[model samples]
Target chain A: MAKTVTQEFTKGLWEEIAPFRLVLGLCPVLGVTTTMENGIGMGLATTFVLVCSNILVSILRKFIPAKVRIACFIVIIATFVTVVELLMQAFAYPLFLKLGVFIPLIVVNCLVLGRAEAFAFKNKLIPSVADGLGMGVGFTLSLGALGAVREILGTGMFLGMSVFGASYEPFAFMVQAPGAFVCLGLMLCGMNIIGSK
Target chain B: MTELIKMVVVLVLLSSSSGGLLHWLKTQTSSKIEDQQVKFVKGPALKSIFEGSSNDPTADRFTLKVGETEKNFFVGKFDGKTNCVAFEGFGKGGYGGDIGLMIGVDIDNGSVLGAAVTTHSETPGLGAKAKEDPSFVSQLKGLSIESPILVTNDGGKINAMSGATITSRAVCNAANDAGKIYKEIKSQLTEKVKSF
Candidate 1:
């Protein structure tokens, strides 16, 4: 049974969310979510690359030899990542500075490669585009949510504004490395519970 | 044979086009990126060094060729006189790598105005103090540009940050280099400052 375009797109939002469900591309998912702003910036950059690579891969799927398909997909992804890096540096220097090395590292994001191989390589242009956009938006929302949780609990602040009053003591650990793991685990557990129901 | 040929052709075409596109984009954004770097990275140091200047030091700047390198010199107007110039110097032997120091000097008296670390990669809470803690750079104020700068360990007046002697030495080294550059271009700098 073949799925419709809407089904393909919606699946990424909850059923196959990259970080939580697919468990793909954990490096950036964990590394950049210390702050909501950084998380969103990184997610959007990745999204740009994902959408571009998917479109190109879908268009050239016929010509790409099976043996060298991965290599071609990487080249496409890398080109878009560089484009994002240059544009970000030119227009959003502060956010670019915060995101730093992760922008370049997006070229190696497993989610992008996985999508190229699994979906874009076999699908038509429109569905490939929808898949890319859905996955990208899903990744962005997950990072943003995770970052908000971490920022609120760790610093008693939301996007630099104090959420808890002056009396609230922040859980500094929530902003640290170990905190990322614990928080992710709990979120994953919660997601699973909701998913099962 | 066709399979190999197709793969090679596809790769070459993709790589070359990618290169061409990046090159063009880089050229287009190069100037904007430079402005951003100066605004964010070097802007703070220049602001502090030229705190009371009548004009914006970043906007009022000129570049001069010194030994095959074009170095930017920011002009600061004080009391309607533009006799102050600030420039950057790099110090080698830092813990992480070379450290960049922005030194401001008064052309008339040949005295130091202020100095700040523009870029550094030293350990946090230690060598990084050169950039973070103002007291270390404050000691460099008002010193004559003609003499070489050194830490107290080297029998000079400036004191090194505790447990960060290497970083402190690197900063002093940068100050000394800036002084050398200043003396070499003193006459040319005065001429340029008058035009500003």
Candidate 2:
């Protein structure tokens, strides 16, 4: 089947959904999803890096020698990550502080590298951009959902505002590491259920 | 050998181009980035400590060369005199490595006006509570850090934050260090405040 450019973009929303279907890039997924804000911030940052790296990698694929391709990819990816890091630090210092080490850690995210190697290196520019945006948005949505669920359960709030009422005690486990794993597991299970239908 | 040389050239070209691009971006945003650091990261702590001063401390800030590198000093003016300063201090936390806390010192009295955690990476609910609990930060506000500040666990006056002894100790120790640094550079700081 000849895949349309739209397919490249939309598949990542669910079919090739990351941290679920693809099961890639779980580090930030589990670590930074303590708040809806953190989750969304991380998602957007990843998307920025992914989109730029994908487009750059696709443009330079022909010029790049296969022998040193991975190294080349790393350099390009690292540059964009640094740019994001600096911009975030200057303009979004509060979010930057909240996200902490995870911002720089985006450089090593498997999803970014995987796209660079598997798709961008072989695709045309428009499709590569679409794939980056689609995948990045998908990743952001998943992480944001994880954060929203965790924050609501853990703190009885969404984005730090009271949600479940004063009488309801927050289920603290949702914000902890154990909560992250369990929540991710249940989410993946739910995704499986939907996929089968 | 020829192929290897070409590969080296490829790597070099890619690295140089990326490096150049980053260098340019950094130059464009460096000032704004510095402005954000003051406005957000360290601003709250500075405001909390230097509250009600006649002059804006952040705007009246300066840098002093200490040890090897330069350290920033945010000055608060009272009655047109720069009398207070705030700067970042580092402490070793239990889990997430270095903890950064902003320390505000009264230049004349040599007392810590107040403190706020600018950055930390300890366990979220436990060690992180150190930052959340205002009392923990307030405890250091009026103390004379002439001697090393110790938590109750180490047999001193300050109460260690519940369930976060190591993080508590780290912050106290860092605050104590800030005091010592303040004492060490009192004369030099006084001279710099004149410029501010």
Candidate 3:
């Protein structure tokens, strides 16, 4: 039982990330992540929503009938997402605008709903929370990794801080939309290579 | 009968509670969000154009008679100086849908001081970079009314992003449109000020 718990906690790190592996929630992952700051902001917001929704869904799992389960799950997820959105606005307003609607759209993020239906509904409270945390971290890392690549090559910068001197012209396209796909695909490929080994 | 009642009750409670929670949350955060919006995005975009000014964004729209064309726009003024002026238009469609940009123009001159993505459904990295890149935006600064608003590839002043030709052109086009309006405004205002 303890071994299974540990696996659930760690599984999100590599085995079942929303992006890269399962290939879920690609919109916000790619949309807001032009810089490391944006990626971190988006990651933490999504994580907060995931953890809260997962716990709520798990607690109400038995009470919620299977036919209405998805609707119940959406309501729970939307509540947590609103909280996350409000919290970001209250405290991290700059990051909030930077993130834009992607924050509210967390309600529909496959990762949050996926966890509620997959692990949270089936697991106990502690394990559900653990799974959410693990998955959130995995998603965050994925966004951060993608942001780092785009920022560095596209602008010779990282997280808005300029790393290169005036000599650099910066590959302007690397920060553009095409660069986002190329970077994400290459990163996923790299992750695949590492995982295989 | 019992099961149906229970299902109805549960859905009612769930939806009402969710709506109530969202309403409460929005009420609590709306003011803070508006303040932060001024402090961060709008403020910074304006500061990049005008250095520093108290951010007081008015939704007031103005029609500047630029020759025959009457340009309408939202002006962000800081302490009497026009910090930034924002205007919107559709971009050439690409892999992403229509790209919309809010160009912030500096008052000292009609130069593009800063800009932001008002609306976009562009592809993840390529077209979206126009919003994310300061370099792409920076090129707009210090731009005079005399400068042609074309990309470097097309023998223009601004640099276009690799693999994002259509997107880059779209942005450059907005800047050009704004720059043209600015020229007419400058000439009109200068003549008006001289007459006074």
Candidate 4:
């Protein structure tokens, strides 16, 4: 039992990591990972929503009827997303501006709703929360790595600070939409090779 | 019948409580949210334009209702006199969406103290240059708000930003729109400074 509980949490970190492994929540994973700060901001925001929704969904799992459960879960998830939105606007306004549309779009992130239906509904609160945290951290790290790669190559800057010296010309293509796919694909390939052994 | 009633009870209880909680949270945070909005996003533009003000315009602000929406006005105490105020209004930019502009006007003279593009969705490296090239926006400074604001391409006083005539036009249109609002509400807005 103890081993299984830890596995549930650790599995989300690597074995079933989102975007790269499970291929979930690609909208944000592709859209906002243009900058390192934006990636971390978006990842943390989604994680907050995911963890909160997972915990609430688990707690209500027994009481909610199986038929109307999806609707109930949506309401729960949206409530938390709204809380995040308001809090972001209040305190973290600059990051909120950079991540304008993606924040509210968390309600439909599939990852949040998916966890509610897939894992949290079937599990107890502690494991549900742990799964959420692990998955969220995994997603955060993945996005951060992607954003750093894109920012460095595309803008020739890391976190807005110039890299490779002033003489080097940035391959601006890495910041555009097509660059996102190529970068993500390469990263996935690297992850696959590393994980195989 | 019992199952149907149970469904109704569960949904009603959950939704009503969620609504109540959200409403309370909004009330608790709306003030802070508005303050931060002005400070983080809007303050720099207002401060940059209203530089001579003795009072921080972001802090000395009032809201005026236009239709159902409330518009924020920032007061500037230029030379210790509070006759200047700033506000952001929208103009349709290169795209179909609204372009936000922060405009400062001398209520006494009706001349633009300064203007800046606070937010926009125009094409980067072109239309986005309107915000980057300070000279493009500086052209509007000291122009009488009574005259129409427009890019020279459309037979106006302002020069069009090189490759971004559309965005340039949008900024002019936004400034003109803000000017009209300032004209109509100038009396009410000036009254706000009386207590200051």
TM-score of chain B of 2: 0.87
DockQ category of candidate 3 = acceptable
The candidate scoring highest on TM-score is 1
Q: In candidate 1 chain A, what residue range of length 10 has the lowest lDDT sum?
A: A1-10
Model 2's TM-score against the true structure: 0.86
**Candidate 4 Cα errors over 4 Å, as ranges:** B66-68, B153-155
Candidate 1 structure lDDT: 0.92
In model 1, the runs with Cα more than 4 Å from the true position are none
Please state the Cα-based DockQ of model 4 relative to the true two-chain complex.
Answer: 0.80
lDDT of 2 by residue, B76-163 (tens): 8777877678888888655688778888877777777888887888898999987777678888877776667888878888898878
Name model 2 segments beyond 4 Å from true. Answer: B79-81, B89-101, B109-112, B116-176
lDDT (Cα, tens digit) per residue for candidate 3, span A1-197: 56466788788888887798889889888788788788878998899888988888888887887878898999898888878878888888877768888988988888889888888998899899889999999999989888888888988987667888878899988788888888899888998899999
Q: Could you give candidate 1's per-residue lDDT for residues B51-125 as a string of tens digits?
A: 988999888888998888999899999999989999999999999999999999999998999999998899998
How high is the TM-score of chain A in model 3? 0.95
* Tens-digit lDDT string for candidate 4 (B89-193): 788755536788898888788888998888887887888887777788889899987678877778888888777777888888889889888877777877886
Cα-based TM-score, every candidate: 0.95, 0.86, 0.63, 0.93
TM-score of each candidate's B chain against the true B chain: 0.95, 0.87, 0.56, 0.93
Worst 10 residues of 2 chain A by lDDT: A156-165
Candidate 4: residue pairs that collide: none
Locate the minimum summed-lDDT window of 10 residues in model 4 chain B. Answer: B89-98
CAPRI quality band, candidate 2: medium
Error of 1 at A190 (Å): 1.1
> lDDT per residue, candidate 1, A1-197, as tens digits?
28888987888899999999999988898898998998888989988898999999999999888989999999999999999999999899989988888999998999999999999999999999989999999999999989989989999999889998999999999989889999999999999999899
What TM-score quantifies how close candidate 3 is to the native fold? 0.63
